[model samples]
Structures are given as structure tokens and as C-alpha cells.
Target: MMIRSALAGLALALTFLMTAAPVSAQTVRVGIVIPQSGQFKLLGDHVRQAFEVWNAGNPGVFSDVVEGDDGCTEQSGKDAAAAMAEAGVDIVVGFLCTETLAAALPLLTAEGIPVMTLTVRADIIAEEAARLGWKFFRLAPRAGSEADIAADAIFRLWADQPFALIEDGAISGRELVEAIRIQLENRGLKPTFVDNYRPGQATQPSLMRRLKSAGVSRVFVGGERADLAVIAYEADYQSVPLKFMGGDALNAPEGENPIPEGTIAVLAAAATSGPEDQAARDAFAGHGLIAEGLRIPAYAAAEIIGAAATRMTYGETSLQDLLGQTTFSTALGPVTFEPDGERREPGFVLAILEDGSFRRLSIEDTAALAGDSN
Candidate 1:
């Protein structure tokens, strides 16, 4: 009878141990929703590569990647958000364009899942945060900032030169042009011309003629990859002798090499493999991923999520609590969020085409460019 009682007690203890042992901390699944197939495909590829590298470093952290075909469209974004919510993703990252992000914002915020957005449009993220609180965090700079940077770079490079502004109707493009216009006006300078063009138009011959007729020596353009390529190619074809300046979209990995000569682009500095970005790079490389610009934000997003998860007492932590009061060192720089969820970092860089490759231009600062052309 005694032996039987001891056996029963041992069995009970074993059962309790089995039940309480933490189950290897089930995979922290992250869902990436972006345009896997569409006009923004190259940007999507960059984001995907960054996530892949980060995931490779930390094996088994991601259970799976749920592809959201948000082709920068409202319908696609809504569908993708619903699918991700239905699939029960712990976190969702990547909405590169503003339109898609706007579409999915309501759904994702309502579900209470934290989203790390790579879209650069400030207004969309700001408006969404105003409506939804800390559920959305942006990793990219605002359109106004990019435009200001571009204006400063151009003014410094070619002081007292008549310039023109062109855009391709992207939200980033329109806002950037406006910002550049504001900067030019602040310096008592005015653009020779300002106009918007439809995307993928065969040639901007008429616009090119107007720019040349206005005797514009410098031009600032705000557009995505294809638009930049088209404008550059058209300018070359039209023999427009103006120097071209652009925003971050022109720095895209896919379209970098094709930019015509005499074109300078302002872009986010690529995160280099140095002491600062090394550990995170290693973490991402361990997963067979190459951490690049914009992608670094994705890895940082994962790190943020992981750190927050570690601090939670089992299921007690909420996404809001985790994101509301957390900071992490990212490849871009130290990332801390305001109540509005915008990253507080001075993160843009100006790159000029030197011998067919884009290289960073050394500018003192945006504000210091008044009356000086570097």
C-alpha cells in the first residue's frame, strides 16, 4: 500500500512538471504584409530580404511569413489585413506605400496588433496614429523632411541658379515638391517651373522643352522608381542641360544604376556593417539574410517585439504596453518613439552620382545651406 501511494505521488508530480515547463516558448510569429507583386515590387523585395536575414540569424523565431499582396491599393490592403488578423499573427510589418497602409490601418489598429510601417509618407501615419494611438510606428522619414533635404543639397551645390520642380503624383512626390518649394522660397529663390506628370508617360518632351526654355540650371524631381527612370531618360533624350535632384525613391536598389548622368538623389543613408550595425547584422545574417536600408527597420521591429515579449509575464503583456515605452538601437540609429509613433532620428542622406554609382554627399546640415552652394 505504501509503495503504491509513492508511485501515485510521483506520477502526479511528473504530470505537473510536464504541464508547467513552458513549452519551449512557442515561435514568435511575425506577419509581413507588402506588395509581393506590383509596381512597388522591388521595394517589397528589399523589405523581404531584410526580414529573411534577420530571421536566419534567429532560428525558429518566426513560425511563418504571411504574404500580403497589398499592391498599394485599398482593396488589396483591406484583404491582406483581414487575412493576417484571421491568421492570428502576433505582429505585422511592412506597408511600404501610404495608400495601402491607410487602407489597412483601421483594421490592424482595431485588432490591437502593433504594426511597424516602412512607408515614408508622414501625413498617413500621423493621421492614423491620431485616430488609433500607438498601434502604428513609422520607420521612414516624412515627405517634408526628404524635400527639405533635397532642396538644401541642390541650393548648396548650385547657389543662385534658377531651378524647376517636377513630380509624378505619388503622395511622397507631391509633398516633397511642396517642401522643396518652401525651402527655395525661404531663401528668396523661386523655381522656374513647377509641374506634375503622369507616371510611365512615354516622354516628357513638352515639359523638358519648358524647363530648357526657362533656362533652368537645376531641377528637383519627386517620383518613384519608374517615374525617376522615365524622367531621367526623357531629359537625356531631350538634351536638357539641367542637373536633376530627387528624393529617396530614386535611391531604390533596382533603379540606382539607371539614373542618367548629372542627376543627384537624396536618400536615406544605407546602414553599413560597422560596430553600430554589426550585432544586428550578425543576428540577421545568421538567418542567411543581408540587412540593407529599410530592412534594418524590420529587424529592429523584430528585436523590439522580442524584447517586449521577454519582459512579459506569460500572456500579461499587450502590444501597446510593449511599443509605448520601448527603445532600440537600429541600423538607422537609436530609435525612440513619440506618442505619435514616429521614429525620432535624423536619418536622411544626400547621394550624388559619381562615375555611375550613387555616393553620399557631405553637407553640413539642412538649415546651414542658406546662401551657400556646396
Candidate 2:
């Protein structure tokens, strides 16, 4: 009885709560499986707002949608996908967190729903998808993409400085640091120190001491921003003039700007740009969800799905095959996935925190370095 009632609730929600009026014929039933609640609730709001913009386009080929919140938790992720499957969605998208999509994959596979998740777990599409014979597409950068861009930016900004690499001992962090280290070594340059430290420790003065002893003036950190900030504080106490840099984790919310000014980070998602960008942001804000961070990517996801819907041949067209065959034009420009379902175009830019805000560092005309531009 409980399960039946739950299905009825989900069905009603999908049928009515989706939009104010009934969608026209040939509407695509999309299941948006993202965290609508939990620690990642803000990301949920951004995605919802972006989807609403996509929904506003007339007879927008996508509808009958159901939403599920994994709260960035595993069990919730599986349950959410299962619930959406029961609600009769044809496709699933928007798994922002890694664990969320991973937990939901088996259920989605069993239901024969193809998922195009918005995450950076390249291994899923790179290895697991083929191994398990599950159709999963990743709309974000592969894990290695982060390191690739970071290395390029580092070389552009401080090619001659003595540098160090640090990680938090987590798989993600370790992989990121090692990727950069290898790329640097390939260029015949090596980092001054490669260090791994436990996360959430009270202090890391000892690590700071070691780095200072090595005459390391530039750092590439592959872990939590809080830890980076802690490193900055300890460096200051040790009177070591150093610049701290890292991947996307540098901008992660950690209560406040823990790292000192001039610290840099590389992020995959860029800010919305131009008139089209403003229109999306306006539409996103109009929906009551504050737009930021992941909003552009969310909008890009909507555009990709909507474009794919245009090519769907109701009875005969295979969605999974079409996805691999077509190129999607997104807010981030044209997006085409590699065979492993990773985005084909990958790059990173340098951004430094200045005056309480992060700004892009243009290395185009950098006069402080060698002419390594290609």
C-alpha cells in the first residue's frame, strides 16, 4: 500500500507539478536526478532554475519530468533514481555529485534509462561503463582534465619558480597531484617537494617547515581549500613568501577566505558570458533560485538535452546511439563527447583572488616568462 501511494504521488507530481499546462505531443519525459535537498541544496536550486528556463521555451520537447534529491548521499541517490524510474521517465540527467550518480547507475541501467550525468568521474565513462555495459555519459571534464589545465596555467604563470605538489591523501586529491607531477616531469621539470598530509588536522606547521626548507616558493595543492588556507597561515608564521595554487577545491566553501590574497585556483565551469548569458541568468533568477557557480553548466545540460530531443524519432530512434552520434551546442559552446563519453574539448584558466573576488589571470601578454606559447 505504501509503495502504491508513493507511485501515485510521484505520478501526480510528474504530471501536474512539472508545469502549469499540459505539454504538447512528442514531449520527452526527462528525469532530473540531482540533489534538491541536503548539503548540495544550493546546487539543486541552480539546476532547477536553469531547467525552468529550458521549460519556458514553447512546446519545449521535454516534459513529464520527475525530480529526485540524493542530497549528495548514496542510498538517497539509488532511491531517487528508482522512484523516478517508477514515475516513467525516459532519460535521466544532472547527477552533480560523483557518489550520487554512481549509486544510481545500476538502478538506471536495470530500468534501461540512459544517464548523462554532470560529474568529473572520468573512470566511469572511461572504464566502468564499458566494463559493466551500462550506458553512462559524463557532461563534465574527466578527472585528468583538471590536472591538465592546472599544469598549463602553472607553466604559464610561474615556469621558473621552485614549486611543490601537495595532496590530502584522498583518491581524488592524490590522482590530481600525481597527474600534474607526471606532466611536469614530462616537460623535464620536477616539483621541489611532493607531500601528502591528512585532512582536517589542527595545523600543518611541520609541512610548512619542510616546504620552506626546500626553498619552495610556488605550490600546487590538490586537496581541500581549508587545508590550503591552513598552509598559507602556517607559511606566514614561518615568514616564507609563497604562493598557493590548486584545482577547483580552492574555491570550495570553507566559511571564509582562508587563504591569503593572490592565491589561485582552476575551475572547470566558467561564468556565463554575453547577452545570452545575461538572459539565462535573468531567467534563472526569475525562478527564485540564486544563480551562480554551476548555473552555466546546468543551462548547458538543458540545451544539450533539448537539442538531442529534436533528433529523436519517437518509435525507432535509439537515444543512446543518437547521443554518441550527435554534437551538442551548449552555453559553453559546442560539446561533443569522446567514445568514453568525456567532453572532447578540455582546458583550464588561471584565476587569482584579488580584492575579495577571483579574477582571471591573462598569460597572453605575460612579460615575466619565456616564450613557450604554442
Screening candidate 2 with a backbone cut-off below 3 angstroms (N, C-alpha, C), the clashing residue pairs are: none
Question: What residue pairs clash in candidate 1, if any at all?
Answer: 53-284, 53-289, 56-286, 56-287, 57-286, 57-287, 156-373, 156-374
Each candidate: how many clashes? 8, 0
- Point out where model 1 deviates above 4 Å: 1-28, 35-49, 59-79, 86-88, 96-100, 120-122, 132-134, 155-159, 168-174, 192-215, 223-241, 252-262, 270-295, 310-318, 363-374
Residue range 137-156, candidate 1, lDDT tens digits: 77666555666677776666
Error of 1 at 274 (Å): 8.0
Candidate 2 wrong stretches, greater than 4 Å: 1-26, 69-78, 96-100, 120-122, 198-204, 254-258, 270-277, 313-317, 363-374
By lDDT, who's the top model here? 2
